[model samples]
Target: MARRRRKSRGRKLILAVAALCLAAVYPLQEQLTDGGGDSRGAGNAAAEDVSAAASDVFRDGSTLEVHFLDVGQGDATLIRCGEAAMLIDAGNNSWGDDVRDYLEYQSIGDLDYVIGTHPDADHIGGLDVVMEAFDCGTVIMPDYEKDTQTYTDVTDVMEEKGYELTLPQVGMVYELGEAAFTIVAPNGEYGDNANDYSVGILLEHGENRFLLTGDAEEDSEADMLDNGIDLSADVLKAAHHGSRTANTEAFLERVNPEYVVISCGEGNSYGHPHAEVLNRLREMGIKVFRTDEEGTVVATSDGAGITFNVPPSESWQAGEPKG
Candidate 1:
């Protein structure tokens, strides 16, 4: 009887060990199924990846000029400091050639940073063509991955171009010449809504600051406020194409921007630059420029003050002083 009991006890111990092994394997299996290997090391690995990929792109400088391209009905922003250049959100796929022409017009052959604020087609669709036309130093995007064709096209181009991609994390700062571009929102975990998941960037140069809000809605804006981030800026990119769902009055009070740019299409389906949002900005005494109305808006800063340049024939609207 004692011998039989010892054998049964040994068998139970073996079964317990087997169960533990399965439990360990299950997490790794889940990670693999999700895509690539476990993300346990993704955080640590991302820094190195970004450094390696972008090491060749940026150059030190003190002056910077950002062009909020007038890609009708979509968003496409370009940043240039000295010889380094960065492209953020390439508009819609139909605007691919237009984006390429704009880059060529600016003589931007090599891109230090190619940022897709989110996976939405209107924001990232033209990236495939841009990537094909110019050499990219590094591609930064939000953490969430969608299975859309635009996403696939962008990924395929990245693979084809041998470029490594890194997701923009909160507090991650990229120094470009004399300016510091920092990711200020969409930190930690992914938000429930895609618009709320938008990546927000704060570009600082000396005393000048520009806040780029990538369609981030009120929920994300609340998160930013709760975190006590310095939302004040000299210039603001109106969120969600200036939709009624974003740019709350409370959030605007914190930003208190001198100038605001709204990137939206002419007679868009969404009726962007909503009347309520416009009224709020107007109340704050902030100057507003819309791509639909103002061709391409360019804001140049020399560390202390900023100047606005609207396409010829277009007059400055509310806040801009007559030159």
Candidate 2:
């Protein structure tokens, strides 16, 4: 009888251990499926590795579409090229779901790059939520050292998600098929103001080039010009949401973009798209679009020129030029 009792106790102990192990694994498996698992094993087997993800998405010969997402009071831009996608600066934290929904609506299942132009909350705030929701390939940002809580939270989530952080540098190129993106600003030392440290990128496809300037001020813009980087583009994102401090006349002349997109919120405190900046763009005869008025702006290219589409308009007839 004593021997039998001891045997039964040992069996019970083994069963309990097995139960605990199974419980642990169940949660891990669940986490992986719900965007909480090891970043290495969640995506298509081909995207299992970060480097592989970049190479697969950027393989030569891809079409590109640039979407200027409407994240009110902040900035969020999405670039889609073939099977790959990249996001630049998620708006304020409140717009995370909007960003995710927009991605889902467009059938984007994987993200190749997520760039936080700077540490400002309006720029990097929504990134944490995005990191938690997607299996990101890699994250790139300016080399800014700030002590803000938002910055800390963004870094913590990136580290936790096992994302490789890359610092933007001029001459560095990111390729996706036939499309090529070159970093244009934040060329040297990190700046004193976070905005000055904004990461500027230029995307080129055939004769078409698009310049994205992330709230960079006069100082940074001047530095980019002094460095002799090609500032010309067919499309330009107006710096600092069209603030007077940016879009300097000389810088605008160098870019000479045919179209300019400004991202700003309605009734914003800073009075973005200042009168002076608007006049400058008007004087240059550049077509200007604003998120505050147009909702979202999308630019698509087919290896040659680009086309613009606005939300359906009843007042205007088909083929009619937009005001």
Candidate 3:
């Protein structure tokens, strides 16, 4: 009876161990069968793998960093090429703190270029605050002026800081670190409209190019075309807050950017990022990233290829629309 009980106990122990092994292997087999093992857990694992790839595209050093701050219905772009930095528009007055905080977060101690783009309240409202907060090298604005207090405030700060404002001329080039940029708009003449006088910049780092049109409308774009400037770029900052008033098809065709960025507030009163502009981009199969939807969008380039802060979704990777 003692021998029989010992054998039975050993059999039970072996069965229990086998069951545990099966339990472990079954879940793994089920996972493998589920659409090439792309279960939620597997997907998370894949995401981790991709994250670890660490292209080092945006890290400190020779890499170039461009930040599109979420200023809400306005524009603020910060570009950092190694130790050199440039700020393009600081958004409205209300965004002053946010813009400053962002610059500080990026460890920016001084600014090589502070651009106002235009004198519109939405464009220069925070210029005074930025100028007051940081040591700026040069301030760039259009030749046009506005009669509002917003304009006066920026000038006062510039005067207080003993900074001279330079009117960007067409074909003028600015070299910062390893990057270089050309002023492509406010091209020699001004129109009665403020939007037409907006300054446009084409920044080049290695082979990568970025075009930022600060509310520039079709007239200015036409001037760029007439001047026979190279308009092809990797990215285009859609003008006039993506209003139909700008981003003409001809301009888009000439630029042929792979990606387009539109900056505006969510549910803005102006109904910005008009459908027409989005339609044009979609028709051209260009990828669109919006401030309202994506929050602050940052693009980093190593002078070879560009990378974005957000990764493409799994569905987008698999050639399916994201729900």
Better of 1 and 3 by TM-score: 3
Quality of model 1 by C-alpha lDDT: 0.71
Cα error, residue 37 of model 3, in Å, equals: 22
List clash counts for every candidate, in order: 3, 6, 1
Ranking by lDDT: 3, 1, 2
Runs in model 3 lying further than 4 Å from the true structure: 1-58, 311-323
Q: Write the per-residue lDDT of candidate 2 for residues 153-194, one digit (tens) a residue.
A: 778878887888898878789875567799898866644788
Clashing pairs in 1: 61-177, 61-178, 73-265
lDDT of each: 0.71, 0.70, 0.73
Better of 1 and 2 by lDDT: 1
Comparing 2 and 3 by lDDT, which wins? 3
Residue 246 alpha-carbon offset, candidate 3, angstroms: 0.5
Provide the lowest-lDDT 10-residue window in model 2. 1-10
Q: What is the TM-score (0 to 1) of candidate 3?
A: 0.79
Residue runs of model 1 more than 4 Å from their true location after superposition: 1-61, 188-192, 311-323
The segments of candidate 2 whose C-alpha lies over 4 angstroms from its true place after superposition are 1-62, 311-323
